[model samples]
Target: MPGGRLSRPDRQRIAALLADGLGYSEIARELGRPTSTISREVARNGGPGDYQADRAHRATEQRARRTKTSQLPTATTVVEPGYGRNPQAAQDFQEQLAALMVQTGMPRMAARVLSCLFTTDAGSLTSADLVERLRVSPASISNAIGYLEGLELIHREPDPGRRREKYVIYDDVWLRTWQVSARQNAMWADTAELGVEVFGAETPAGVRLEEMRQFIGRLSEDMAGGPTEAAINDALTVTAALIHAGRPRSTAELATALDWPDERVTRALRDADYTPDLIDPIALRRTESGAYAIDVRPERLSDVQRAALRDS
Candidate 1:
């Protein structure tokens, strides 16, 4: 029954569950069917508010009769020779993965297209191939392809010796997608910073904007793979060692003090130089003796302030 079409009794139970205010997952649990199946059934039969068991059953029967002769064969199953894999199980897993993607704010059609491309042995599919496999209209495939392409999740390549094009998912698709998200987060942070300036920082709206700017800015930095917590902690520890010594110390000396390897100490020092915001108002300086020392001078001070201090 898990993989079979819903029976008339199942539809009646779905209707009853809906009338009882049970959600799709709850109804699916009661019927021992996949949640996607329950959701699709309700969606195709006037939705939860208007769904009727008899009408839904009739519609399903009519659709089956109409599409029986035209239904395309499914070829998305993974078949590894001698692997003892069940093709139906593989296909069901693909569908469940696509459903999970849909729940994560992805468009349903786009999720299906992506899942199909991912599961295929070639990791590529032409428009016609997608249409045949998905049994959907060409327009729907076209729209889904455009959405995926816009997000950098897929790319197009000309089919060799053919006029049609193929959509491809590469091993680096997730990397590219992550870079896109990092860029978008940076843009959001920039916009929020601008809002802070326009609304005046003391105002409530500006306060909210500033919070957004800080949170998104940090998120963008992390996504960009800048300065891990371990690196930051190491840098802080090195800085503390320098302060405790009250004098410039060589990398070897700092390493010995902290019980760290010289390479680790050197890497920590480099990270400290790269991300100075964590220990602002204090500077890490290389003394003429070729040793590391802490400078209390705020290097971020304005030129005028620096000149004033120099004059003083």
Candidate 2:
């Protein structure tokens, strides 16, 4: 889909497509490419939203200049055609894509496994499929998938009428990924605020960390309650509606609705602190399969339950 030495015309078209908001799959289909090719190209270049033909071209030139400076003889020996119609070409593409993925923050083997999936026809790939396709050991594929799943870049979906599960990448992958980063930043920012009190900002280390705290704190405030709780709540309520319309609710959903903040959400969940979860009773409902589902199932607390909450 995305690899090969794209012609100047092709680069222009790709940039146009990106600017028009075409998804990777749509662009790939139009170009008669595997989506992985497109994904790797965009990721390695500058990513979809930030991609510019001239900028990517200049970056590529800069990288080439660096490669020349290294002047390693093996560089010429290893440089292969961008797109391959043969097994060797496919392997070469995978390896190159793997290296590029590492630059994008993924580990080497995880990148290899992920790139291999892009070359396949089925959107979903099983553990066994990965092992066979990439010619890696079962254990290696398992481990790579585990890490990728942990990053929330991939998800495990149950096989219909089958026992096995397949890893899937959805259209909303990057959107959700960005949300994860934002939540993490918010948590660390909150921790930094706490640090200011424990370690006075007058000291060097404390001051440096406190500065980071202020920076993150400002970002958090802009995102959530800093400037306006009304805006944050409005945005969150819409997201909640979207979730409730589709998937089942878990502890995560309860925390988000209660506005517990990300840190308190994780801490309260781990410590069995019911404060966050108790905000929305309907959020705690269980479906027939014993899985939690979101609905308008409010609980009427008795005199004793009310007293317990009051005491806590």
Model 1 scores worst on lDDT over the 10 consecutive residues at 75-84
Q: Which candidate wins on lDDT?
A: 1
TM-score of each: 0.56, 0.42
lDDT, model 1: 0.79
| Candidate 2 segments whose C-alpha is farther than 4 A from its true place | 1-93, 160-163, 218-312
Provide the clashing-pair count of each candidate structure: 0, 4
Estimate every model's Cα lDDT from 0 to 1. Answer: 0.79, 0.61
lDDT string for model 1 (110-185, tens) is 9888888888778898999989766789999999999999988999999999998999997787787688888898
Span of ten consecutive residues with least summed lDDT in model 2:
268-277
Q: How close is candidate 1 to the true structure, as a TM-score?
A: 0.56
* Tens digit of per-residue lDDT, candidate 2, span 138-197: 888889988878877788899788789988865565565566666777789767746655
